[model samples]
Target: MRCCLARRRAANSPQKTQVSLPEMKEQLSQLIQQALDALAADGRLPEATQPTIVIERTRDASHGDLASNVALTLAKAAGYKPRDLAGMICDALPASPLVSRTEVAGPGFINFFLSGDSSRAVVQRVLTEGEQFGRSNAGAGRRVQVEFVSANPTGPLHVGHGRGAAVGDSICRLLSATGWSVASEFYYNDAGAQISNLALSVQARCRGLGPDDAQWPEDGYRGDYIADVATAYLAGEKIDATDRHVAGKADPDDLDAIRDFAVAYLRREQDLDLKAFAVHFDRYFLESSLYESGEVEATVARLVANGHTYEQDGALWLRTTAFGDDKDRVMRKREGGYTYFLPDVAYHFNKWQRGFERVINEQGADHHSTVTRVRAGLQALQADIPQGWPDYVLHQMVTVMRDGSEVKLSKRAGSYVTLRDLIDEVGCDATRYFLVARAPSSQLTFDIDLALSQSNDNPVYYIQYAHARACSVRAKLAEQGWDWEQARGIAALPRLEEEQEKALIKRLDQYPEVVAGAALASEPHTVANYLRELAAEFHSYYNAHKLLVDDGELRDARIALSEAVRQVVANGLWLLGVNAPEAM
Candidate 1:
């Protein structure tokens, strides 16, 4: 008995048994192809062509586990009606224990039904894999850099930054989960007009000039936080940031000193807000570094040498129109200062040189106009960068709501709702979830009350409660002097044949596919939606069934199922940078 148990343990180990939904789909496709080959061999159809076999999960349970339209795709080439071809393909399918039966449905759709054992195998796989269950190697160790929340260090991080933080970090997590070597970057525009404006704003405040004062720069920032910076600067406060440290000179006339101090100070503020939001960057890329290193000049030289640039009105302009732009864009202003487009090209070229085959820039929709210009600039460089060299994920605006009205201003940030405010009020977990649960392309409306709610009406809480409830069941079982044993649970999974149990198992089986799809499509919202659906299935099953029944086998099976759900919920929440609480 001891030897037999040891053999079973060895067989169930993660390294020994690695089954995934994608692998299952591939196996089904291979089986279908074999069937098609046999049909061609027997002269029932023309020789099989090299058609791509696509397998998708059936939406309706009555159909089967997986459905393929390979027959429909190849029927015309095979000179047979689609429905007739599907029937022949089904008849030619090789016998397999994994597939209990095959059926031909509408328009040459071949559906394969898995045996009960095959369907139930996912439970064992989940238990064995634990947190690693849904992860995949689709990315194959490709290097990708996700630059986001690259907010200029002019002020604190506002709610818009919060949205980018949530989405960008989640993208990194999803990519990492799918075997992509992802670098999370926060690019800071430390040397630009924005910094100059910030310094002027501080200087005016230090000189006792308000926004209404004629001395104040036009359209200057007027937030109360500007006064705080002015006070700190006049007091000669020292500031330290990720890239630089500076001490204020207490000289309001020293505009350069104020510029350095304000940039460092606001960078620190943005850092704090990010810390509170539970987001961190692998690197803090300073835009000033590009200029300091002469990359901007080199990039312009490349553009000019490639004949994509010309002199116009005492300024150098890139023939952006050549690369599909509406018109040419100025590369360098007549004042010898390069336009923002130059530095952007330099930064992306820097990213490309860093050996990132894939680079995703997550920014607000307001930066949409720059996308065309930047890509055109890269193409002009003749670096052989793809037409769409660095991909972009532009998120729309986020509006914060409280008391049934839009709350738009933050004293800390000067003009918008601060990210720290949301984190402080609604908490890091709820704030991240609310920000990321929707598609980034859609404008998000963050309702403060909705995020703060502790009940099921809140999606985050609802999903977390499912995990906690599962934990509670195990705690209760332990309190009664019983513990879950993997051997017994595996032995008893066959007893889980109830409708709700089957439904829960089916939902759990979809997680790996969901993770791969979300990662490949760069859509973390898919995982968020999948988690909610999984939670709903678990909740329904919990409400309809008793986990600790009189039947020992059934009880063990149910507990195993609940444990799988809890594990998955925890994994899914972790992907979104949200914690899964044991009790909430």
Candidate 2:
């Protein structure tokens, strides 16, 4: 079967500070629609048989700037051969200022060649838009809540958590860039068995007991950070976190005191680590608050009242199977304590009550099982919440490499590599870029040696170096006692007839579309990949031609192009939470 190509639409609302460039692909789609409409008006084609118009960029420049397969898709229904239908569609098309001409390509494909003026207009658009070049109001002020890096305060953030932070923050940035009212949240699992173990571990350490001790609490934490927490508790140190603050009682024998101090201490540590990594959360929702505020009990009561629960062998079982689970899940165990997923349902229920139309959770893959249970529990509530009301972006594990070997453990975080180690060693820019340079669904191997490299071999460096090169051109222009006027540069746009200049201009025109696509798809890596290609194009152009030429008009035009490249690179890097250095 022949595949149908999908059409692209330009964003409707553009910011006042930015000039919105028309999407050439969308313009072609509209022209195709007009042709179909004209055919329908003449009764040559049925008015009711409307096919989706698809316009795509051509693989080879000779084909055209854009191409469409609508003719091929509608040939059978239109009662015509493929190429003949293509000819009819082309013949019916109306004239447009953007598209210079159209052609019937192989197998009934319609190719569109963009006018030279239309293709080169993106440089001026880039300069006019400045920092707001790629931003669009695609979401129309919709509310979205992004919950990410929701780690328990039991320990410091590991590399896995680092990946979550980087990806989640970038997702929030993308959503904001697309004009979504985004709220970032971090869920704190500060209750349940994990906290119990953490308390016991701190208590053991406060008593001068080590992990190797026979009397050390069972299933206790073995990390040396536990010892640090214990020492802080004994010293009466004041600990402050975003949501709470506590002071150590300096009493080792008090387990409750130790637990409170330790939780606060570690939370503060995690906050510092995230701050260093340039990740921030609007709110810290604690799991313990669900029980403290009676939300968990209210959820359970509602579940029972709604006939979705039953007492089975001294335990309350939820009918998750009624919704989608393979088997029923226990809501409350025989001992009367609730399961982990119960509070999750309550938390998400709270999220719904807060008027968030869309909620996306960025979590580790380990939470895969909880996804179904949480959704099923929400369904069982019968709250009119959609079955898939909340969305998820689960990132796979990250493997850190050093000297061609897997680096598994950290001195601070006993069981896994700490996020801080990576940030401190490779710097935040490289760390953020590497963490988010790939699809979150795919496993990532972060090579420390590669990240630290300063050559073209490193993607982050290469992209940043391109921005720096553009900045250098401007500096050199100033150094040569040449004042560039925007009016002059814009007028000189006609002089940009070189192949390299045309390629760069075309690529610059696609930035807004790329931003919109990546934002809607929740794939920041798409922006990352685009930046690398864009940087390569700029670097190649810089190598082939001289920006500071003796010819006045050509020099201004080239400088204008360089400035556009710099602006776009800066804008793209800002979306990914990486720095676009003026000098690298």
Candidate 3:
């Protein structure tokens, strides 16, 4: 991403600023699109009007920094051959100092070789923008709400939830980094049967039953934290009731005592665990609150009033099938209990009502069925959403491994590993990176051995080490009494011809485009991949180039380049909540 550091403070946070881009690439892409459209009109090609012009780096430096495959992609439909079309498209390209030459490569791929001057200009933008590298307001004024790690307040979050935590959190950061009014929320499931079971299990434990006791439901939560919570609640309750003498009134103190103890205990566990794994939530929305406000009932009533609900078998059923659900889902079950769907709809509706134009929910793939139902409900009650509504992102599961064996995570069985346990074993940075290293849609095996492996095999540590090394270089620069602030600019940089430096700079240049593309596509995992790739480029650059040369201008230029690399690494890690330490 091209570094341009123009940023505005986040609405809710004073510590964080939202980055805005310089809009150079979008301008360039528009220009290229126009060229393609013009070429098609000249009858040199068929339908080049809407081409997927990918401006990417060519493997061969002889080709260029930004390569376009518009000509090659249109080859089949366009009567003209690939090379002929490429030539025509080349002829149609707008004249600009940014683009030095356009060449047709293997299979008629049109590659634009940009000038060093253009690359130099990007660094100047980076220096000028400071910390807003790769920022853009493409989202304009739209509000986007990202609800993630909505882990039911059942037990401590597990290693399996780590990926969703990392992915969802990173996504929110990416959206916020752009110009979206992004709100991060953690959906607390405090009302479901899950919570009821938790309360029941705590009561059972209060009666001094074993964790494996039959009184504990077969499907109840079984993590160590449950026992801890139950023990703490019981101790606090007995201690409180014994000390208080309320004649006839139910002491609100006792109720609060239990709730506060439980919430505080669990909150501490979450903070400690997430800190270990580097995930954070901006807001925690309690499910009970939604019910308390009668929003859930109101939503159901509104749906019924809209003819989007029907009564069947003495139960309220949503006509979700009308809007693409596999079948109508029960809004309220025959037992007179509302299903999770009802409250979920109301919660999201409340989010939209709170002025968020877009609501994004990231759930585990196990919630695939629920996702469908939720989307269906939203579509059935689409009238509720003024414009943009809730979008469900169902990420595949993450399985944990220890010494090459799979660790089962069944929240229902009352036996599983916690996210805290994973961090205690592998550290947070590794945990976060490993989860986000892959596409969220792809199920990943969280291999403990691979993560702990000290070799370059550990990608998270590899990236972190690169950052630490860069910082160490800066320290070295300071120790040498070199003034980093008064460093020479990129133009002062020699015809930077080192294959490694050129490659790193090229990768850096692609950052803005990747960020914009990812934000527009609503695919934040792309940013994660881009980070890993950028870090790798820096590592390669570090290993190959000697930055402390005697040539002052070149040395300063290299230092500036390294600083930019460090800035990006820190920015990426900041999004992930992973530290960019001065030393490993």
Give the 10-residue window scoring lowest on summed lDDT in candidate 3: 3-12
Cα lDDT tens digits for candidate 3, 125-240? 56556678878787786888888887765567776677778878778777877888777888776556776666555555555666678776566555656667666665543322
Candidate 3 positional error at 526, Å: 2.7
lDDT of 1 by residue, 1-584 (tens): 67545645654556423456678788888888898788878887676455789999998888888999988888888888999989988888889867889999987899988877667778887887899989988889999999999999877788889999999999999999999999999987887887889999999999999988877898688888888899999999998876678898999999999998888888888888888888989999988899899999899889888998999799999999999899899989999988888899999999999999999999999999999999998899889899987899999999999989999888676678999889999999999999999999999999999999888789999998999999999999988887788777865777788877887888999998888888877788989999999999898888888898877767887898999999999999999999999886
Q: Count of backbone clashes for each model?
A: 0, 0, 8
- Candidate 1 residue-wise lDDT at 365: 98
- Model 2 scores a C-alpha lDDT of 0.88
Poorest stretch of ten by lDDT in candidate 1: 10-19
What would the per-residue lDDT of candidate 2 be over residues 1-584, giving only the tens digit for each residue? Answer: 01111100111113211233445566677788888888888998888666788777776778987889998899888898989989988999999866789899899999988777767677877887899999999989999999999989999999999999999999999999999999999998776789979999998888899989999989899999999998888889999988789999988778788888888999999999999999989999988899999999999999999999988899999999999999999989999898887999999999999999899999989888888889999999999999887999999989999999999999988889999999999999999999999999999999999999877699999999999999998888889899897656765676799998988887898899899999888899999999999999999999999989999878988988989999999999999999888886
Which residue pairs collide, candidate 1?
Answer: none
Model 2 clash pairs are none
Q: What is the lDDT of residue 18 in candidate 3?
A: 20
